[model samples]
Target: MDHNNMITKFDESKYLISMAPVEKVLEAGYYLNLNDQSNVLDLCCGYGEMLKLWGEAYGINGKGVDICDEFIKKGNERLEQSNLNHKIDLVCQDVKEFKTDEQYDVACLIGEVIFGDVSGTIQALDPFLKEGGKIVIGEPYYKQKDVPQALIEFEGDLLTLEGLYDTFKRSGYYVSYMAGCTDNEWERYISWSARRDLEWLRSHPKDKGFDNKEKWIDTWYKMYFNYRRPYEGWALFILEKI
Candidate 1:
C-alpha cells in the first residue's frame, strides 16, 4: 500500500494544505503591500491559491511551479474561470529544476521546507529575486526546544521559532512580520483533513487498492492528536533580504 498516495488522495479536496488559514494567507500578501507592478514567484505552489488570492486582492502578477499535474491543471482552470490567467501562470515542474532569467519582487516557499533543508532552499531561491525583494516561508517549528529526538527527526530537523529566525538571519534575511497558527486553526485544519479522508474512504469503499486508507487515516490522526498538536507549531515568516 502506497501511504503517500493515500495521503495525497486524502488532501485532493483541500485548497491550502498548510496550517495557515485563508485569513493568514491574505494577511501575508497584505503585509507585502503587493500591487499591480509586483511580480512574485511561488515555489512548490500547490493549487496556486495564494497566487490567486494575491492576484485578486492586490492585482499582482506571479508564476507558480509545482510538480503535481493535477494541482497545476486545476489551478489553471481556476485562474481561467476567475479571468486571472494573465496575472498568474501555473506550471507543472519540479521546483528544483525551475529556472527563470526574470527577477521577482517576492519569492515564496510556503509550507514546503520538508522537501529539503530550509536554509539551503532559501539560499537557492535568493538569486531569483531582485535586490531588497522579500521571501515568505511557511514552515513548522517545535513548540519547545526540548522536544523528543524522534519527533525532531520525523520533521526533518525542525527548528524552534528562535532557531528559525536565526537561520533566516544567517541566510542574509531579516524577519519582518511573523504569524503563528493558533491552536484552534491547527485543530480546524486537522479535523477537516480527517473528515475529507474519511469521506474519500466512504465513497470508495469497494476499491481494494485503497483498503489501507483507513489505517493510514487512523495512524495520521493519532500522530497529529498525540504528537504534533502537543509539541509542534506552524508559522508564516515574512523575510526581507538584508
Candidate 2:
C-alpha cells in the first residue's frame, strides 16, 4: 500500500500563480461560514485570486487591497465579466493607508503580508477583523529543523511550523486549520517563476541583471531543491480570533 499522501495536479493554471493549489484555496474558503452578507478583506491580494475563489465558492462579498495598479485593473476587469462584479471589488492602495470602519468577517494576508512576520501581520490585520473573525494567511515556514544559517538569514521573517503555531496562540488566535503546499505545487511555482524570469531576460537583453539572470535562476533552483524545498514550506493557515 502507498501510505504516502496523494497529490492532486490541476490541468489549468488560473490559481497556480501561488504555491497553494486550487483545492487548498477552496478548502481555505470553506473554513469560513460565509454568506452573501459576509465581508472578506484581502490585505495583499495578488490579482484577487483568493477573493474570486471565495466569492464564487462561498457567496462571499470581498474587497481586495493591492498596491499594484495592474493587479487591481485586471482583477476588476475580470470581476466585471461575471456576476461577481457587484460581489467583489479590488482597490489599488497601500494596505497601511487603507481606511475603513467596516470590520470584516474574514481578513486575508495571503502571499506576503506587508507588516512582516506572522505576529506582526496578525497585529496589523487585527483591527480590520470583527470579534472572533477568521484570518486566512498564505505564508512560508521552516518545515525542518537545522536550517542553514544562510537560509535562516534569507528567510528572516519565517519561523518553524511549531513556532508559527505557538506565535498564533500567543497572539490570542486559534489555529483552526492549515493546508500545506504540496511538493508538486512548489515545483509548479518554481517552474512558472523560471519561465517568467527567463522571458523577461529575453525581452530585455541589455538590462543590468540580464547577464546574471541565468546564474540567479540556477542558484535559485539549487537553493530550492537542495535546501528550501526540504527545509522550508508554504501553507494556507485558517486563524480565528480568540
lDDT by residue (179-232, candidate 2, tens digit) is 888888889888888887898888998888887898889887988878788888
Give the deviation of candidate 2 from the true structure as CA RMSD: 4.4
Candidate 1 lDDT over residue span 8-84, tens digit each = 43443367766777778889889998999999999989889889878988999999999999889998998898899
Summing lDDT over every window of 10 consecutive residues in candidate 2, give the lowest-scoring window: 3-12
Model 2 quality (TM-score): 0.89
User: Over 4 Å off in model 1, which ranges?
Assistant: 1-14, 199-209
Q: Tell me the lDDT of candidate 1.
A: 0.84
Model 2: lDDT equals 0.81
Clashing pairs in 2: none
